[model samples]
Target: MTKEAGRGHALLVGAGILCSRLFGLVRQRVFSHYFGLSDAADIFSAALRVPNFLQNLFGEGVLSASFIPVYARLLAQHKQEEADRLAGAIAAALALIIAVIVALGVLATPYLLWAIAPGYTGEKRELTILIVRILFPGTGILVWSAWCLGILNSHHKFFLSYVAPVVWNLSMILTMLFFRHRDADRLIVYLAWGTVLGCLLQFLVQLGPVLKLVPGMRLKLDLHSLHVRQVGGSFLGVAIGRGVVQISAFIDQAIATLLGSGAIAGMTTASSINLLPVSLFGMAISASELPTLSRMAGDEWSADVATKLSARLNHGLERIAFFIVPSSMAFFALGNVVVAALYQSGAFTRKDSYYVWAILAGSGVGLLASTFGRLYASTYYAMRDTRTPLRFAIVRLVFTVALGLASALLLPRALDIPLQWGAVGLTASAGVAGWIEFHLLRRKLNKRIGATGVSVAMMVKLWSAAGLAVLVACMVEHYLPLYGPIVTAIFVLSTYGMVYFGVTYLMRIKVCVEVLGKMMRRIGIGG
Candidate 1:
């Protein structure tokens, strides 16, 4: 794709992602109001861990990454018949697998909940199992929907896939609003059903355009196809990598469960907030750039491929550092106020805010690394070399688990840090892993693209500008009263954004200028 087209696609995806994230915040606010950081909320959130872990392992982790590129190749070769057959066979196999998994999940809900969150014993554990059983089916629906999304993405139909998450969030918000007061458990049930409904809607949203692109798209059961085998093999490694990541989460939660009642909820809530910016930039960039990268690889445009890949990677990293570094500083400075304003309305309290802030602080530190990791992983996948990332991912998992366990055992009493603080150690481990992965990926890209064309000086300027922006933001936050939490957060964010952009412009960073120029053009203000 041309640079302009790529930017346009990224913009659209970014806009859709922003919408989904905003609605998701609204949903979280509603949940906080109804349940606070109470045991009920913790149970509901904890119950989701196993199911979501499975979805990540199969859906986003393996299936989308492995399947989309191949599907794109088939479509590009004008092999619609073969492509449709592959999709059908994959869909049928996924369906059977999902059904079996769901059955197991439902049956094993009790043991799963105990294994993940052993801190809960009587009522909390029972309620968690109940919620897990209800929500377990969502995994299967989302897996099928992910396949459809991959199909849409391969066709460059990016808008619907981006918009689908917004629909899901909206559905959950409506459920929460209607059922929150009637029965707390009613809200949980509605949320579970809403998830399944949302996945179906998400799939349907993509299916319309996909059918138009590939006529005669039918659902058939053909496990013997060669295309199916290729997808299966590619997905196997991806699944293992994803499974390891999930195991890390399980370990994190298991440690939290052993810590205290509010530990799991606090960590989950904080992590969600941290993920907002990461998902907005990191995932969006990776998703938007993947097809282009894959196409370049397919066509064997080695030099062009490397140039574009480096440009995109640098742009993504600069964006992440620019936004996340200052955001993390601000989060640590104003976390309590931010949490209180957004979540302290109903069941949530000042104490809950305190716990959540601690988690958010740690997550903030990891935000840039997490965002960078997403882009790094995408680059490796685009090159069709999943094994390298998988190897790194294994090391990451081991580091995360070791740090989490050690922190839990040693840090709480010695440092007077609570058990919830284990998340901090986990985040630091992830950040280390991200740095390692980033360097490795960079070395690999350099080897392929040659050393002469690299742009080290530009990145240095970008990082310098980011540092200056953050310094200004810290000063502003310190001097300004900003009245309430809501006002303070808004003012701090606005000031930080303006200062960051202004400094980047003064530095004349190319990526910043390019992004700003696009924004100006979109607003009809550019020449």
Candidate 2:
């Protein structure tokens, strides 16, 4: 694998994620237009998540955190054969594991759907199970696509793996467009089959690039390889951590199921939007840093090694905060506009936009903490200590479930909070738990290597600029004449961004200053 230390790789990955996320937004828009936030959409949304439990527990999160580091280290040490062998063995194992999981999931779709959404009944419940069965094999195929992502990221081929999922998104969009009136039930079934085909295509697209990086890497049942065993050890720990996280998500869905019609679909739409910033900023930087950090992990511990790790950690956090802070602000202040611009068409209404925005606002609350938490978790993996993250993930899950139950389930009735507010409660509660997780990760990281991450002043400036942006956005929203949703969004967002950058410049935010200065110089402007 190749390791490059530069902002360019991170930018490339971020740009790819940006493109993929845009396509993902389109995918959701198509769904909203065709299915709206009805029980059919609810059925599909909740069912989609059930099979993803397999993907979450066994897919990218575990493989990237565990396998990539080790594989990248082997390549750095000029042990290409060992890296190839490890990749092959892990691939073989996942193939076997995913095949079994999919088969069982297909057979047990009813139980799975019930666990995911116990409130579903009659036709809704039956439809959810049927769609889940169609989606299971596809989910299994996509889990292996995470395998492709692991291989590509190890080799600094970040762009393709991140963007390739656009194919999957497009598949769904096309299905809906073609069969937009095929009765909601049959349309959802067609949609599920489209998803399966898309997953197959998404995985195949990456195989060529992966083979280019690791030649002759055919699958081998070589669990006996020492390197394979090492990856397996790391995989088990990371998988447990991912499983707990998935359980938290599952809990949210199960609770949403009880909340009433449209709750599951509403939250699902908002969550896809919420993930945009996390994937673009958080995943981009963390993925770019992994290959380099993996090599550092293989090095002998010393004062210099510790210094390098801390410096890398701090710099990565700086980049993460810059983009994510503004994203949180936009979601909090202009979520309805955002949702309306993207999704208010056909069956989706202005009311649906507000409902989705409410959840988006709540998600914004913990956006920074959750994103920063990803870097901290990656830091632990780089240090070869997956147990700490697993431990904290368990704590986070407990907090998430408790808070989720109190706010999302109980408070809505006891306190007379609206049903929409119940969805907000779910997202906001997760944000609170995210802060707890971030705090624990930071404390452990500080104990491991003195102090790490960005300075207090930098954080304050980020919050201040974002706060200022919100006020400006509010003023714009209040004063500006109404227009079409998309146009209104463009006008407000463009103004908010200009005002934000202008204020950040005045505040002398160092990351903004430096990145913009470099852009100016690159374009032949004054120094």
Give the candidate number with the greatest TM-score: 2
Name the lDDT value of residue 182 in candidate 2: 97
How many Å off is the CA of 226 in candidate 2?
1.2
TM-score of each: 0.92, 0.97
Question: 33-123, model 2: which lDDT tens digit per residue?
Answer: 9889998999999989998888888888889999998898888888898888888888999989988888988998887777788999998
lDDT of 1: 0.73
Candidate 2 minimal-lDDT segment of 10 residues: 1-10
For model 2 the TM-score comes to 0.97
Who wins the lDDT comparison? 2
- Per-residue lDDT tens digits for candidate 1, residues 334-396, read 677568777767787878888788778766655666676776777667777778777877877
Give the true-structure RMSD of model 2: 1.6
